[model samples]
Target: MKRQTHQLVLAILADLEVYLKTELDNVVIYDDGRGNEDVFFRITEKEHLPLVASLVKKYNGRLVTLTPNVIDDETHELVYHFDIEGLLINCTITVTDKKIPSITPILKSADWTEREMKDLFGVVPEGHPNPKRLILDESLAEGVFQEYIGLSDAMAGAATNKLWEHINEAKRKRD
Candidate 1:
């Protein structure tokens, strides 16, 4: 990350922070201190996601990736990684809601990412155009995070086998 790019990102983030505070409550920003990497901001209010997405779009950022992190038993952190002008901004929203508004309406790249989150976390992407399965099999249950309970022995064994087979296939293809 160039010094100029770093400063530019910081400035944009600072502006976003101020804006976020004014528009939404319980927003916290964390700087990883590793230059141009690993910055996180958490939005406590799920309703504010659309506004956050709008701000990211206004800054000409592209939604790079979205990840569902099982933070705790009742909470899942929906991390929306956005890249703007060579800077990565990770906006995380801790969700307990069964559904959250879709950002794909604003960021076209969110289409598949939102669906993937829904499939994996069972976090419904409300208003998503195509909220279909991404990588999960129809037979396997959703929200089956590795650490999650209620995972049956048979299902776990089947998944482990499928995973190994998929990994071996990729290795074979590469070879």
Candidate 2:
């Protein structure tokens, strides 16, 4: 049942890559082997990102979320989660370029998700209509979440407190 649907999705993706003139092997799909039926795909090429997103949408896949993580001092990884029928497909892109193009035009829901990455990781989301801060105050600083980068204790505590106060104030305003 679920396995069959998963296989169908694989076939759909393969056909899509062929139509898009992309290398199907580059879209590597693998599971964690935990018998949990969760599937993952690491889209190995940067240029094919939008094509993959388009294919997912063509298959009626919905963008669940997008997340970013500092992969290293020089790079960050952007991951996208999409749901096709009952199957989940994940696409990851490792970006060394400070500016990555926004997929909002394709995913629509990626508007804020990419903005969050931009605000927190300092990875610029080029072409983002509203390239404004999503999670941090303009005064605090970007890349505060990067644990690899050392920060002074005074700065760290101050940034944390500022963030806390901002959150509380926003909540108060909402209420």
Which candidate gets the maximum lDDT versus the true structure? 1
lDDT (Cα, tens digit) per residue for candidate 2, span 1-175: 1245556766777766675585555455555454234456566566677777787777877778887878787688888887777667777778887667777777787888787777777888777888778899887667666665345755775767865776688789979
Where does model 2 exceed 4 Å of error?
1-3, 26-36, 148-175
Best by TM-score: 2
Please write out the lDDT profile of model 1 over residues 44-67, one tens digit for every residue: 777778877887788887899998
Clashing residue pairs, backbone N/CA/C < 3 A, model 2: none
Off by over 4 Å in 1: 17-38, 137-139, 146-152, 155-175
* Candidate 2, lDDT over the whole model: 0.72
In the predicted model 1, the residue pairs found to clash are none
Instruction: Work out the TM-score per prediction.
Output: 0.70, 0.72
